[model samples]
Target: MRATLMYSAGDVRVENVPDPVIKHPTDALVRITASCVCGSDLWPYASMKPEDGPARMGHEFIGIVEDTGSEVTTVKRGDLVVAPFAISDNTCEFCREGLHTSCAHAQANFWDGEAEEGGQAEAVRVPLADGTLVKLPVAPDSALIPSLLTLSDVFGTGYHAAVAGGVNERTRVTVIGDGAVGLLGVLSAKRLGAEQIILMGRHQARTDLGREFGATEVVSARGDEGIAQVRELTGGHGTHVVLECVGNMPAYQQATGIVRPGGVISRVGVPQYEEAPIGFGSLFRHNIRLAGGPAPVRAYIEELMPDILNGTIEPGKVFDTTTNLDGVPAGYQDMADRKSLKVLVKN
Candidate 1:
């Protein structure tokens, strides 16, 4: 089997690796059909990541179940399924409460070790199979492949951010960033009935997709200028809700600055640092609600799947490029350099 491995900063390689085998009674082995490089993957690929050994990269995928552990029963061999990036046992207390991303067992599974194998490979071993895998209605059309694959992460995550930010019939939402997740955030806001959608972007192509996804306005500003424009658009009140899709420090502050006093700022970006300063003073004074983190993808997938199937949400539009497993490095470069919105990898 071949997999994407991260050796160090700016060092990503496609190399042969051992095939995965089920190691837990609740685990299943999947033959990845389609996988994509996530914005999160770039964090480690473009900077220092701590690990004693080579780490399998990627975590967003749609695949066929090759085999399942003894306890697995919801899915059988040959079923096509979408696996959420976070592994969870749906029956746990947290999972039952719709907080699968914070499931005790799932979070505990990561705290003791170097983390599990990633999805950017030919095949992967997925734990919590019954809870994590959501079987699609049928083998999707080739045209639907990219969209279906997005349910594993970005689309689902973007939807979570919109929901957390409280998009509704009268809300004006601003999405910061033009990446895959940000583009999907625009779609999410539209679907949830936001009255106005503004996407802050620098690229024409990405802004165009923001329109396709229902952005009513596009601001071609960066840093303070962008934040000021977003504020101006909202009649000096700023946005009712703001979606922060970029994980870095600058984007994080911009997200906070561009929302109304009582607005909600939802961050889907994975912050690169262990300690990030939240502007608690402004938050406390303005009564703004700050929310978001790794999207609870498992809890939201069931509701979101129907929208994707019916074409109500065209999240696939975010996949501006597609390539094979061997072209993993180019996939990273294109995204890192903003040449592509997102890349879909075929196994």
Candidate 2:
């Protein structure tokens, strides 16, 4: 088997690695059919040190179950399924409450390479098999594979941002980014019935998609200028919700600047900064609440899959490039260089 490994910043390799096998009664082995690079993966790809060299890459994927452990009952060998980015037992108290990312099970985890496997490979060992794998009605050759694969992470993540920010029919939203998650945030906000959607992004191509996804306005400016544009568009009132999908200090500051009092700033992008304003002038004085974390996408698969199936939305449009396992290294470079929105890897 061959898998992707980040040997250091800007250095990715697809090298031969050991194949996976079921190691626990709650585990299953999945042969990856489709997977892709995530925006968050770029964080490490930008600055990972030599000491942190060679970590397994990829968390989102759709695959066929090659085998399952004795305790796995929800799926069987040869079942086509989607694995959420996080591994969890859906029966846990947290999962029941729609927070599968916080699953208390010993084996539950995000795909951070602690398990010695990844979705960007020939196959992977899935822990919490019964609880983590969701059966897909589509076949291997379905045209909906790209859309279905988004359920594993990006679309669900965008939905989490909208849901957590309490977006509703009357709320106005400002999504701070035009990446896949941010563009999908526009879609999610539109689906949730937001009154207006303002997408902040510099890229013309991505912002164009944001409009199709439901952005009523696009602001390509940054810093105070960007804030002024959003305010002007909203009659100086800013917006009721700010979906901060760019996980940077500047993006956070923009969110704080553009959110109306009593609004929420939802952050789904993995933060690159450790320190941010949380004082009265930043959030407390305005009564603004900050929300969003790793999306518990496991809970959203069923809720989100139907729209993709019915063609109500096409979140898969985020994937502008496709490649095979061999093209993964170049695919990462394309995304890092802003030449691709997202890259889909097919086996």
In order, what is each prediction's RMSD in angstroms? 2.1, 0.7
Best by TM-score: 2
Q: All models: lDDT?
A: 0.84, 0.94
- Predict model 1's lDDT versus the native: 0.84
Clashing pairs in 2: none
**Model 1, span 1-347: residue lDDT tens:** 99888777777889998788889888889998899988887777677555634677888888899999999999889999988878888889988988778888842232112245777888888888888888988673467878888888899889989988889988999999888899999999999999889999889998999999999999998788988888888898889898999878787778778888888989999876566545666576788888988888888888888887887777988888889899988898888887878999988
- Give the count of colliding residue pairs in each prediction: 0, 0
Report the error of model 2 at residue 257, Å: 0.4
- Runs of candidate 2 with Cα error greater than 4 angstroms are 113-115
Residue 208 in candidate 1, Cα distance off native in Å: 0.5
lDDT of 2 by residue, 151-217 (tens): 9999999999999999999999999999999999999999999979999999999999999999999
Predicted candidate 1, C-alpha RMSD: 2.1
